[model samples]
Target chain A: MLNTLFSGDFPRSRWLTGLLLLIAVALLLAPFLFPGSRPLDTAAKVCIFIVLVASYDLLLGYTGVVSFAHTVFFGMGAYGAAIALAKVGPGWGALLTGGALGVLSAMVLALLIALFSLRVRAIFFAMVTLAVASAFAILVSQLFHITGGEDGLSYSLPRELTPAFRLVQDKVFDVRIDGRLLTYYLVLTACAGLFLGLLRLVNSPFGRVLQAIRENEFRAEALGYRTVLYRTLASCIAAGVAALAGVMMAVWARYTGPETTLSMDIMVNILLMVVIGGMGTLYGAVVGATLFVLAQNYLQTLMAGLSSAVSGVPVLPNLFAPDRWLLWLGVLFILSVYFFPTGLVGRLRGTGSGR
Target chain B: MSGSFESLLARLRGGDGARRSGLLLIVALMLLALAGVGSLPTWITLTLAGLAMGMMVFIMASGLTLVFGLMDVLNFGHGAFISLGAFVGVSVMAALGPWMESASLAVNLAAVLAGAIIGMVVTGLFGYVFERLVVMPVYGNHLKQILITMGGLIVVEQLIYVVWGPDAIPIPRPETLKGALTFGDVVLEKYRLLAVAVGLVIFATMTAVLTRTKIGLLVRAGVENSEMVESLGYPVTRLFIAVFIAGSALAGLGGVMWGLYEEVITAHMGMSVMVMVFIVVIIGGLGSVEGCFLGALLVGLMNNYVAYLAPKMALGSSILLMVVILMWRPEGLLPVAKGR
Candidate 1:
């Protein structure tokens, strides 16, 4: 049953399997194990990013397509939910409606972009997407009446999902049984289901063709596969899943804005997580998201400590300033591309040179 | 002179008349704008503003296109150099505050020149290191090149934040260059005129180098087929490095101009302008200078006209132009035929 669940693609390396199990257990029991709002928030974010980055990997790693527009779809999903909830009033029905709206729009936009630009060279597609995504971001900001502009949209969730509503009359396992906890679990569950769906999609016969296309498009086409059709399909699927991740984010944060969802920084962060986790391996997304989120949360505190420790130094404090953490991550990203192009999961699984 | 002009036109048109069509498109766009705008002075001002903006974009994009042409290396981190150039140039201008503030045109010009030269030198040197460290390893692989260059971009941007702080620095234009040049009812900004002149000089010099020099021939040949050039005993690698440095230097010069034009400099400015730069590069064709120039002008003119006509639609004008142009000519307005 477990093998079937994973589509028979087990984490071949024992260490990898162990790490995956540990992450799963920790996330599953996050409320009980962590027992704090911040920790729980971090856990929830890890879940959303895992799905987001994995969906990206489906295109970048599995299909060998580099798209800068993934975040645009993510933004669409987020805005769709934000606007729907704001307009329709927050409820489970609203959530579902927003999510469906987000998913459909993302798919349509992705389809249009794929059909129009996918016929061109990969580099050309990357440029076109970058241009389009930036333009979309501008449009969103300009049409502030609908999107709340740069300030973003913040609205209430269903009563049961708000912190004011308690799930139980008393505390359970030293944790407050409030709507927040329920929402976390809801996000976690949705992410798990979405992630599993992606695993199933990538491991199917359709997935094998994507990998084949990634390896050699000419050969795949010569072998009678319509490469563009498959690529376009892969792009659409990735876009839809990315939108779903955005919906999950909206539910968790109860707010949506261009800064949080559509910014180029978020796009860069997604790229970093996907690359550092290991491309082509679904498990990498889980590991990457966990590591990146944890680092994002804790690394600043660590840097603050180091900065104070070297208070008297001339330039060292600035270098180790908490905000400069991305500099180190950038350096790490470059090094990984050169030395460990396969990423941490790839290394653990004993995958040789990167594909 | 007329005969020489005819010969130049013939050269630009080449065998396929790509450049001629690109030129005609630019004319058509202006005519459309003239009709829509109706007022000739407003049209002239908009056209001049558009041309100046186009010149600045061309300066930034020319090097990028050549680098892409010479080696299929699309440096996603090209914006890093642009930012670096702007920051460095601004710093130099700040240091030369006295000269910059002077009422004399020559002194103010000298200060700006100093900033541009120093900025170019620093960015050029950085580009060499960037080529060696960030770009050299990912040759021949498009995906890795994109990833690695992007990595370089992030690191450099963060480093800029660390060094310059996360504040937008205001740039003071020279005293003589601050006001507008009045041509009867049509007034043009003095800084923009300088920009146009600088852009024209760079464009002319670049054209001369590419067409009239031995290195230019080798670079052009290298872009078409580096291996063949190498087998013919030219050092293709050295040529590529030179092109990369030159490209970085030009981007730095553009950065300086862009900073003064905006009257402010920010690290993120490079990234923001990069969208326009990419549009221009793609519209012009990957490696063609003439194409890049025409593309930049088209985007710039379209941007001003659209913004003036409909502020809301202004955001998408360049992108709309790109899509339309791409639909018409998939390889761009003037594609440099590349040999694999």
Candidate 2:
């Protein structure tokens, strides 16, 4: 599988490979080495968002499409799984069935939207998608009987995946790892596999064509490539993979809602992640998502210290408050876009030129 | 009906050709349909309500329309201006409670004007900093523009929360603008009437500035061919800054009006308006102020009428309106005549 993935490469892609390998190793060892649930949970979230953001990059970075409807696909995956699990109850059978159904439905939705709107100018298509996607979110919440409305639906996971189904009660390295650790590992492996799959797809000939389309749509059309079909296919593929990420999100959080899964905030976050990690570079997704989720998880506590330090200062405490980390994240996002348009990965590769 | 409205708007915006009339005629027909479902008085009330809402939307969206039209900047952070305006206006009004509570119309109007002036000035000044610090970096890169502007929005919203507190705050209408005006069996809310009047004044001012003056001429010419205007030795850069400041001020003004209309302000209020603003901008044409006016009115009327007639469909009505509009005219209701 590695040979197949690397076959077309010129073999100059060393740094990204090394970085990705380092992350993979860290994720594998996290359960044993990480001491607390907070960090572990954050790690798991980073994993899910890595796939989610990379799939978005597939469209934005690769195919030169800016879609605002990505979270809808992500939401569909969670909702599909949540609704299915609610109906089928919890088991390996239920999980697989619901997850498969969820992923497939998300792909279908993406495909339909792409096919319908891809013909318009890029900006107009974006607006159409935005309106449609927001409507979908509202519709989901309004379907109170089926969707549980604003409350959102949560269902049980398989018993073996639950924390109570412990392989052992205690831990090594002062880490009390057991069934919950197993869940993290489950999420890790799935996420890693999905990330690898995305990397391979982007490195493949199809991905090269997508890059070509992004570089110059008319030139690609002149070369006889079916641009619309390719874009639509890319959208479908990205959506399918995003749905997989969504399934993992549901499995991890055991909950999904409009705010968590379908909000425009999440959509913007994914966009920021992809851009900050660097567009057109697959590893950027992992790097960006990891950076973002970590910052979100840890920045508040970091800010909390600052807030308290400034407590003696009038008005400074409020400005430095922990809850205002999103404000900081926003600043970081803008700064990254301005100074590191190639993103962290791109800068790491010593390519500072903007995408 | 469509033709008449288009011609009217064409004359108003100084465009030579008739634009799409579907929106105006369709909106009128929708009102007619609503009249069939409810009493005449009910329809009139809803119509007035919609016009007021539409007026507010236009006030907010016109700035966006002009900025996008002139600079080609897809400002995702336009919401920040709105939020800033609301916060500034509310803060000013909160501090001037006694003036607002005065029974004298002149005094009440003074307080409101004071609030709006402060809101506009502060937002305009912030627009300068925002343009320099944030927007300047991502010039000509739409993707980066969107991402960075959104970042600007988030930071500004957080700042608002820090400054104004996260909870929604009430901002009552001035005493003189607080009640309704009744004419026999038909009644009109005073605030709505004020909104309509203010909307018209803003629209007229915008039209006059765009059509009658040198800056307006340059802006219109810039919209048609910015490079050409630049080749004529005009400082397009300065013009860009002026337009940005103007657009920010307009958004602030609209925000103040909207806050008063809703009687509550929050950090996320800007976001709530962003969707409708975008919808209106799209339906109007990316850069056409006149189309923005028509589109806002259409969305406003449709939203109110539909909410009253079918509450379940209300959430999707504006979106559905956009879809319908797109189906009929893919380039928008009245696309810029040249290269968009």
Candidate 3:
């Protein structure tokens, strides 16, 4: 049953399995164990990002394609849900329809980009996607009537998912069983389910083909797999999953904007997570998202402490400033690319070289 | 001997027929824009603006194409050098504020020259270090190259923020280079004219060196087949380093020019301009200098004309141009000796 649950692809290492279990347990009881809005928000972000980063892994890790437009699909989904909710009101129908619209739009855009560029060299795809994604972002901001421009859109969810909605009259374990908790649980459940779905997809025969393409595209093509078709399909799947993640984010935050879902910084963060966690492994997304989101949320506070501590030193305080976190992350990203290449999951699994 | 020289020239030109066609495309685009606007003055003004923008883009893109042509390394971090150049140049000019603000043309020119020279030198040195530290480790691997360079870009951008305090620095044009030259209601910015002149000089000088000089021959030959050039006793590694530094210096010069043109410099400017550079390189074809030049001009003109005629389509015009060009010629307008 356990084997079937994991799609017969185990973590393959005891430490990895243990870490995964620990994360799972901590996440499952996050509200009860860590009773705070900030922690809950961070946890929710991690849950959402796991799916986002994992979907990216499907492209970069599995298919050997580095697309800068992952955020475009993500934005489409977020905007789709946000627009739908704003227009149709905050009911389940509006939410689901918006999410579906977002996913479908993302899939179509991904399909178009894939069909158009994947036929060329891999590098061309990267450049083209960057151009297209930036253009899309500018277009979104310009179309203020629909997208709310830079300020973004904010709307409430269904009453059952709002903070005002009370699930239980009294506090449970010193925590109000309100719609916030309900929304958090909903996001967690959806993320886990989506994550498993990605795992199952990757472990399947189709996924093996993607891995084969990543390992050697020419070899895969020579073996009669029709490389472009497979790559395009993989991109579509990744796009769909990414959009779903975007929808989840919209539902949680009750706000969607270019800065949140479509910014280059978010794109860079996604790349960092995928690389630092481990490319080509679904678990890498889980581990990377958790660690990165945690760092993102708390690293500034930690840096603030360090900055103040080193106030007497020249340059040290500036280097340790709260906003300078990306510098360290950037340094770590380069080191990971150079030293590990397979990320922490790969390191834990002893697959140091990735291949 | 003269026949051999002519053949060498021909070889350097790469594709004479394709080159003419690319130039014709530029002319055709201008004519098309003229037809759309119908006013000669507006068209000329737009054309001049487009040419100036094209030239600046070309200055920045030239180094990137040369680097890619000679060494199949796509340095995504090339933008860091641009940002660094802008910051350094602006700082130098800022320091020489009195000279920059002087009414005397010589003093104003001198200040600007100091900024340009120092900016180039600083970026040149930075490129050398960047080549050694960030780029040297990941050679011949496109995937790692992109990822690592992107990592370098992020780090350098963050460093710029740390150093410059994450604020946009605004710059005023040098006294002599400000304002416009009007030809009977056909007005042109003085700085834009200078940009065009500088771009042409660089292009002409590059052309002369590539066709007439031994080093240029070697660089061209190396682009075609580095191993052959290496076997022929030329240190390809040294050539690669030289090209990399020169390319970086040119990018710096472009950065200074761009910063002056925009009248503002931000840490993120490099990355933003990088998208345009990438588009230019792709449209010009990777590893092709002439192609890059033509591509930049085409994009510049397209952007200017579109922005004038249909404001809404301005953002998408260059991208749309890129898509159309790719469909027409997958290898770009003028692919180099061995297209990547």
Candidate 4:
């Protein structure tokens, strides 16, 4: 299995494979290496988002459908799991039931949308999805009985994943790897596995047909490919994967909310991740998610420091105000889209990088 | 020059017949209002409220459709113009505090108009710069347009924070504009009536200009075929830029109206209202102004009616309507004759 994974042009080239392996190893050992709660949490966030963005990439990068409803499926997965646990209490059975339900619901919604909207103009489809996604978020928030309204749903996670449990009494590398460490590893491994699975899926003939459809719908249709069915299938798969990402997020946080999951903000963040990481490249999600999560967490602090550093002269020192961090991020996002359409992963991989 | 301008303005105000979709929408709204509302006074109240809401929405959304029709530019940053216009209006009101405090309706109205004019001028200038810097390079590519313009919106939103602080500013309605006029307990807001009137004026002007005048001819022609228009020796790019400026101005004007309607201004106000604006645009058909007007009315009426009936579902009303409309007519209610 390992030889086939390594040998069958599975991950672009040996250099990329080495880099991906290194990143995976680092993520697996993040808790021990970082030895801090904040860093571990951030890394975990990066992991969850990697799964989310990679799932998004399947639709956006592979199938070429710009769906605003991606976050709705994500939110559904989180809420589904959270609500399930809240009702039945925490156990493997509850988790499995919730995960299955979430995946099932996401696929259902995706199919409905694909069937209804797949034949429309691309922009029209995007607009319809935006409207649907926004309505879904609003509905979730308003259904206070089920979704806990704006406060969102929180419930007990599986005991092994909770922070109360400790696997070791002593510290390794001056870090306490508690049950939270176990959770972090779970997220890391799950994300890595999902990423690799996506890699294999995208490299398959199905993905090639989707790409051909994206490049030229008319030509793809002329070739006797039922583009709509292929797109719908791709959307359903993406929705399921995104829901799994949502399950991971809910498990990691032990909570789910409209603000955190269902909002357009998350949808926009996912889009940014894919675009900046390089759309079309499965590995791009990993890099984009990491880059975004880290930047979002610390960019403001860095800006504050820079502003204070320039306080003596006070010449545009407010350029890096924490509140204005988005301004800079927006500028950077635009510049990247204009200059680095291939993204960091694509650049590193070099010419004609699977665009 | 002044006589010509007046004639042009007159042509704009001339009544034009509604298209098939527009007429159908009006009939549906009337029928639904009658069916759901029951009482005459309640129906009137709801209709007036919906009318006013629809008008405010139309002012904001008209710019988006015009721009899209003219340029095929998906300007996600359009919200920035709206918010800026609102903030500018607030500042104008603040500066002309004495006038705003006046009980004289004429004085108060003039002050509000002054603020609107200032907002429009400033937003138009900003729109020019925004177009040049953010939208020019990424023309013709929808994907890039969405990404870049979204980035532009973020930058502008943050800039608003830097300028206005991260607090929601209270927008005080002018003294004369406050309160209501009641006819046998059928209370109608003074500002809302004014908003409806303003909306009509704008709509008439837009219709007149689009249908009757030389520039209107160019715009309509350009909307149908910009390449052909360009081939006809007219600078279509220049026409597109002018439309952008006008659209931004309208957004600013609408923002001022919405700010007064809400009695508040925040950096994210434009973003919040954008949901409604985008919905209205989609429901109206991507490039049709008349469609936007009809769509806004439907959405506004549905929102008010549903809020009265089931408040929880009120938020989702417009979206539900759009879904239904799209189910029936996949393109939109009143799709333009442009090649999709």
Candidate 5:
């Protein structure tokens, strides 16, 4: 089946493959090049977001379901991991347990939601998910004693859990052992593995069915496909992957809060990444995440500088600053919708497709 | 007719009647439970709050319903327009505060008019752009519409944050509309009443326009069947633009009312109120103005009352209502007329 699928002279050329390999290698090594503390952490965090955005694309871009509450899965993972680590002690065991619990929680929630709302297409589905996620956030926040309310939960976990894995040692360079650096490698590896797995899934017959549903659900149903089942499964997988990213986040941040789990802002960010990068394209998720995070970081820095420069004056700083980054993001979204509706990747493909 | 009445009476006297009575009894018991368990005061407060909040909801829903009715587009970014209105209204009020204070009521009215005009213009421009750029391409494509509009929402939200800053800003209510009014034991905020009044006025005016005016007729016709309206020589594209602008303006109006009622405006208002607004739209039935009104009122009441009864369960009530409605009437309480 796989051979038949790739029988028509593989679409990608040797040069393209080589270039992709180089980019992947560069990305893997990029964190090590960053000397500073914050920049390296930021780079690692961006990878987590890239994983998140990609997982979101699995359902949204590929399966054609616009979920407004995808972050709930991620949050579950984070909280689950945090609880596991706090209660069971930090080790590989806790990490794996946290991941399993997160995925299980998402699966159960997705199943419940899917049973009812999966049959409803488009806006109804979006609204239902939004309601569910919002309710979850509210419930979590209100249960102040357990979830810690708005302030969130924090704990201490060591970086070098397995000392034998330290392959490099250079004390002359004043390289301090940082947990964040180790966390970054682990996340990178996980994201890469997941990305490859998603690639395989998208290439499978199951994926074709999903795409068929996206193109025309009625037609797919007419052809005897169970559209709801496929969609539900896709949502489950997407949620599980998102949970994986969430676990990484909890380990990295050492804190979990209501805001982390049930935030519409995060939902918006993920949506923006998918749309801006390009729907139906795997690399777009990473591209969009990179652009969004870097732009936001730089915008804030510039805004802060401008604000300080005009300290004596009462005028608001530049509109494109970090504080005002949401405005820019909003504008970008509108512009993308209006002018470049297909998004960056779509726009690029348009030239080749001669559309 | 006598035989029919007798049969009806017989049925009422039988097991069917018993079942009906049982159902009614259950409903009555639930209501009593709601009232007896200290839920009445909470319900009243929530109802009032919902009513207060419903005014804005109605405004937003009016526009949303019309757009959905006329064009089968589920505008995900509708909240952005509401946010735009709030930001613009607050900024204008803040800017013109001094000028309005020294001037007469007419000047105050003028400031308000100016604020509304600004909101309408800005939000209309946004609508026009959205229709032409975002909506025009994905006319029948729901998935594409969802993606593009979701993107549009983010862009609009970020733009507001950039222009207005991240923090919430206060938009001063007029001096005459600043405080709460005491009626017996009830203390109602004056601005909320004003908001409701404004909402009613707009609702009435919109109703009139749809029923009486030429454009209104076209809109109504379009809602029923755009192709038929187009075949009759009306410019349906222009109608779409007009509807988009009008809908956006309603959202803006809602935002302004919200700013006044809450006494604070933030970039996040669009997102914060999004779920409730969606609930209103969904419950009211997509593309029905009357449905929007009823939905908003129901939601407002439920929202306020539920909070009062179980302060911790504020979010649960809306979801529960939605679930029940969806299960019973999936097409909503007032589904848009079909095959028009």
Candidate 6:
């Protein structure tokens, strides 16, 4: 029965299942093979970004809502978790509490925005969200007493649950373990759970309604479906998932600030990952996150090498470093929109061989 | 007087009268209140500053509005054009400093002209290339448009950084316009005054071209119904190029003025000012030139007032204005009429 449920006549499902299993195995073996703080750290960060991009795709690709303020929820979650750990305590209970608070806040905010701007569509929704996010950034930044102003807030965490679990030095087999490996496993577990949840949701009746609304909201409304309600629910869920990623980020980074919480860069990064990988496809999120992280790392390395080779030329190697990355990204985005609207994964699926 | 005011209001609200008088009356009252408060600046100074700032905002917002209204392209790299214009203009002026000093007024005017030319040519070329290569592909797809434009923005910004470096560069202000003008205790910067004058000239020229020229007519027609215009065999693609060029040039011109106003140019200016320009365009009804003018003034004043109130709030005033606008008029103050 399980095989029949999993296996469909379409070859795409078989390929997808196979690819997913391969990825799962690779994720499980990553820590043991890499055995380093940096590699594990990168892997963990990639997982967090994957979750973030997937959440963004949930709304943009599936629901057709271009939410500009998605970062606000993510930021809130980071701060929520940070505050909880700092003011309250760092434990599983605290993490759950922080996630719950972030989700509730996001849901309330989504409800208010949706209720007010439900009549407006497309670009109008984008603009309003942009405004709200900007306002939120300013509000948080200005409240220095709480938000730590531009300097940002900092807090120390209690000792790990088991000091022996550290990825860098071990006593049993003389293998080293440290926080990076721990973070990697934690993030990977979260991502896999969320992925399963999202897959189930997308295949359910509720997901069909979302697709119908995305295709034509007016027609869906005429059919007696409450489009706004469904959209709001999807948006809230996306926000919650994004918040989960944010919480993980805060825990991993061990530092939170306005820049980390609500920068436009985060929004751009999430958007790029989702679009580049493929929209409306779960695997697209994974692909986008992987590609974006790898490409950015490679580009920075290349730039750094060039800067070092040319003596006396001060080349700033930062996230906001002046480079052709943005230009290439822009060109790629335009090309994707024009030639491959379904994204790289979608195109591959169309070929009938990838499946 | 009260009876006449009420009648005039009724007529304007009913769309029977032009509402020009009502607008003037409101402007007059605002000016009076600004002066009478003693807390604010003199009426003339406030109005002059507001109008000048408004004019620049209008220039920036017009291009943004046009692209959004006509093609539904978000044009995320709109700021790149502005930064490009400023950098190019300032560089030209710096290069020609000797000639400008010897022939002061002539040199300054020439620099302004040169800046406008460079800004228009370079940015127009960019617009054309971008439209054909980047924008053309993502015509109706919002996600692709957003991604590609954003990517373009990052690339352009990085390129600027590579060329100009990270530090802000100070452009030499015209020697003749270095001092401030004092009007009975109210002091105004001469460059700002010059900016106001130049902005007005550009506004007038744009208005004339858009309203009077044949190309302008086609642009209007294109905006209203792009498919119909294409079907008529009017070289719709060429028309799009013209519109893109003109819009980009306008942005470049605004960038020149911005460089002069700020006295320093940085690569991040494009992204920083983008949100404000977006707000102005949305408020101005997306496609209406006249609406752009009105929207710019409203945003400019609101921005200044917000700055005035910032000491108390800690954050800048624009954020507050954004929230208020989002809450009250999410479609913007003047939503474009559906179906063009």
Q: Which lDDT values do the candidates have, in the order given?
A: 0.91, 0.84, 0.91, 0.84, 0.75, 0.71
How well does chain B match by TM-score in each candidate? Answer: 0.96, 0.93, 0.96, 0.93, 0.84, 0.86
* Tens-digit per-residue lDDT, A131-214, candidate 6: 677778877877777767777666555456233446455443444555445666777888878766776676678888888988
Q: How accurate is candidate 3 locally (lDDT)?
A: 0.91
Alpha-carbon error at A151 in model 6, in Å?
3.4
Please say which candidate is ahead in TM-score: 4 or 6.
4
lDDT of 1 by residue, B1-340 (tens): 9988867855764624877888899999999999999999989989989999999999999999999999899998899989999999999999999999899999999999999999999999999999999999999899999999999988988888889998999998999999898889898988888988998999999999998999999998887789999999998999999999999999999999999999888888888899999999999989999899999999989999998999888749898888888888888888876677
Docking class of 3: medium
TM-score of each: 0.97, 0.92, 0.97, 0.93, 0.84, 0.86
The TM-score of candidate 3's chain A against the true chain A comes to 0.97
Candidate 4 C-alpha lDDT tens digits along A32-125: 7777788888889988998899989988887778888999999888888988998889997998899889989999999988877787667776
Q: Candidate 2, A152: how far from true, in Å?
A: 2.6
With a 3 Å backbone cut-off (N, CA, C), the pairs that clash in candidate 2 are none
DockQ scores of all models, one per candidate: 0.77, 0.60, 0.77, 0.53, 0.47, 0.36
* lDDT score, candidate 5: 0.75
How do the residues A1-355 of candidate 2 rate in per-residue lDDT, one tens digit apiece?
Answer: 6666544442234666677677777777876667677778888998999999989999999998888889998988888888877778988787788889989988888877776568666766666777777788889988988888999888888888777786766666766556677788888888878877887888888998999999899999899999998999999999999999998898888887888899988997898799888898777888889888888888888999999998999899998899887777777777877788788887767732222
Evaluated against the true structure, the overall lDDT of model 4 is 0.84
Q: What RMSD value applies to candidate 2?
A: 3.7
Q: What share of the reference contacts survives in each candidate?
A: 0.77, 0.70, 0.70, 0.63, 0.68, 0.47
Candidate 6 lDDT, B69-169, residue by residue in tens: 67777887788888888888888878777755664777777877787788778888888887787678777877557667767777677678767776899
| Clash pairs (backbone) in predicted model 3 | none
Report each candidate's C-alpha RMSD, comma-separated, in the order given. 2.7, 3.7, 2.1, 4.5, 6.1, 5.0
Give the alpha carbon lDDT tens digit for every residue of B123-208 in model 4. 99999999999899999988788878888888888888777778999988999889988899588888989999999999999999
